[model samples]
Target: MPRPNVWRDSAETTRLWVFDALAGFPLILMLLHLRWWTFGVAVTCFVVFGVLERMGYSVRFALRRLRAIAGGSVKLGQPWWGKRQERL
Candidate 1:
């Protein structure tokens, strides 16, 4: 059984709700408590998560193209946070 595309998958839909809850819960709390600090924290956290999610999608897109180029044979690359940083 092959996996479905992200757009057609329940997993992605569930993730969307989870992410929304992460940001929305903080927002609602901030509003109810009238805390300006939480507003800042919530906005910052939301932005960070948004950036991370975009990075994840970008990496997946890149890997998909690479798999197509390699005839569906794909190998994982070294972790970006590995001990030794590459000198590009």
Candidate 2:
């Protein structure tokens, strides 16, 4: 049998935000303590989220979907780095 859609089960809905915060808190702490590696830390966080979800979507894609359901200003397929000011 296929794995149940644990992510969508109503029982799991509340836990999702809880888990998100739990993961983010450590990253926030590290960012506050370390003044360097800002980009590296952010990329690490995105990878962590994608790994945690174990979904096929890219980190940005996953966040796009999550934001869509949660209501946010982000557009789909936008890179985790946000909009491009200039392409070289």
Candidate 3:
């Protein structure tokens, strides 16, 4: 049997929770600002970012994904903490 992929699993979970919390931040702010459209956009971007992050993608990767959605083709996938440090 193969060893379990614990690192990836934990990374994904952390990414999801981070994005979820980020999404909530804007929503909470919106409650005071009363900007419904901005709130919606924030939520949408949060979900998109969360999905990309959970898929072993970095912030640049998430930005690239958004650019792709906006009709561009830019590839990016560097770990946030740099590749060498990731092994630690």
Candidate 4:
């Protein structure tokens, strides 16, 4: 049987994947409407956006962890470390 943690991880990964895909949809269409060289520039911008998004996700996850720790919820799932706590 799949663990609850596996499900959570899958959901988070899928959500991120969908978000990136949705955000890139318009850029992809615009690139298709432009010249091939312009598509290269679009690709570069897409890469930059992806990097920034990843960094932001990491920072937000860290902040959430810090807040949880401060609130005495250390026993909860550590989403940043991809660890799930066993129910006691």
Candidate 5:
């Protein structure tokens, strides 16, 4: 699924919520019909799963930036930390 522009950064935005709802609708309904407690647990699992995923992405991004710096690849924020972006 494509990430829409408006909801790219927010977890509670209507677009993101709606997309998650539609994607999980069948599983949600099935779990809810099976057992109330199980349905609650499943919803919690899905929401927190995304939180963990976002956290991991951020860590990976930082590591990538550090690796680039160490390799002397210049970037806007770290221009002083490495060689300038250039062509011979």
Candidate 6:
């Protein structure tokens, strides 16, 4: 059977955020030591990234999508990458 969606499960989503927080904590701390304003920026960036992750968005995926669009390979309402006959 196909597995249930992780985002649909509250426990799984919470776990995902927790791990993200753990990974971001050190970066946030470093920013705080550098400057108070930097700390705020770091926290804001982390939160934005966290929300995007929760929404199933990936920066790498977006970059590839943009590349595909620039390459004139992808059309509107279609995937930018995957099983392509031509190289991107």
Candidate 6: give its CA RMSD in angstroms. Answer: 10.1
Residue 54 of model 3, lDDT score: 76
Candidate 5 C-alpha lDDT tens digits along 1-88: 9776995577653333423433354456756589877677667656654564466533234447669889785555655658677788
Q: Per the 3 Å backbone cut-off, how many clashing residue pairs does candidate 5 have?
A: 0
- Superposed Cα deviation of residue 48, candidate 1 (Å): 1.0
- TM-score leader: 1
For residues 1-88, what per-residue lDDT tens digits would candidate 2 score against the true structure?
Answer: 8987766766432333434444464467677777557657765875677586675434446667787889867655878589768878
Winning candidate number (lDDT): 3
Q: Indicate the TM-score of model 3.
A: 0.38
- Candidate 1 per-residue lDDT over residues 11-47, each given as its tens digit: 4423445464444556677788877798897788667
Candidate 6 global CA lDDT score: 0.62
Q: Judged by lDDT against the true structure, how good is candidate 5?
A: 0.56
- The global Cα lDDT (0 to 1) of model 1 is 0.63
C-alpha TM-score for every candidate: 0.41, 0.30, 0.38, 0.33, 0.29, 0.37
Ranking by TM-score: 1, 3, 6, 4, 2, 5
Q: Show the lowest summed lDDT stretch of 10 residues, model 6.
A: 12-21
Local lDDT at 69 for model 5: 81
Model 5's TM-score against the true structure: 0.29
Q: Candidates sorted by lDDT, descending order?
A: 3, 1, 6, 2, 4, 5
For residues 3-75, could you state the per-residue lDDT of candidate 4 as single tens digits? 5665556644333353454346547776668877767766775676567567775424544776987889456
Alpha-carbon deviation at 48 in model 2, angstroms: 1.8
Checking candidate 6 for backbone clashes, the offending pairs are: none
